[model samples]
Target: MSESKRMDPFTGEKVEVDGVYENEAGQEEELHRGDAFPADLILGNTEWKLTEMSFDNHHEGRTDERLVPKEKDIDKQGKIDSPRRQMDRGKK
Candidate 1:
């Protein structure tokens, strides 16, 4: 087993890692996007190594703006946002 330190992007802390790790697993993934990706490896622990990537530009990540409610739509507690809550509020 090998030992290494990696910076945690979320917590901004030093993370200690043990075992054989792929330090440059997705090195090409940063340079590539969607279908234009260069070959990158998604290594697994003694199980697999994924060197091929297939991407579809037709189905990108997008959240419908209609699904997102405005800040005014949600009350202070954020629980009174839906139509059901509006009805409940009218009863009160």
Candidate 2:
């Protein structure tokens, strides 16, 4: 029999596979491969365990925002502020 895959990723850690992860509080989040685990606002940093693997075979070359590290100058609303936005602001 094949062994079941187990993954327990912490906040700021890179996810090894695309899947759904659950925290100690039972909250779930879907994280893609190569994306960093996020920290909970109320719980701060917590360990996350993989609950399911992605069955998606489609690869459209798109990645979620979690691919970027949390320290990369995201806005208060958790949106990434791209360099293009800076240039646009300068033009105003």
Across 1-92, the per-residue lDDT of candidate 1 in tens digits comes to: 33355331211222232112223343322222222222223442222122444444426556555555566764444444466655343544
Evaluate all candidate structures by whole-model CA lDDT and list the values in order.
0.34, 0.78
lDDT of 1: 0.34
Model 1, runs deviating above 4 Å: 1-26, 29-62, 74-92
CA displacement after TM-score superposition, residue 41 of candidate 2 (Å): 1.2
Residue-wise C-alpha lDDT for candidate 2, range 32-71, written one tens digit per residue = 9999999988899999989988876537646665645466
- TM-score for all models, in order of appearance: 0.19, 0.53
Specify the highest-TM-score model's number. 2
TM-score of candidate 2 against the unseen true structure:
0.53
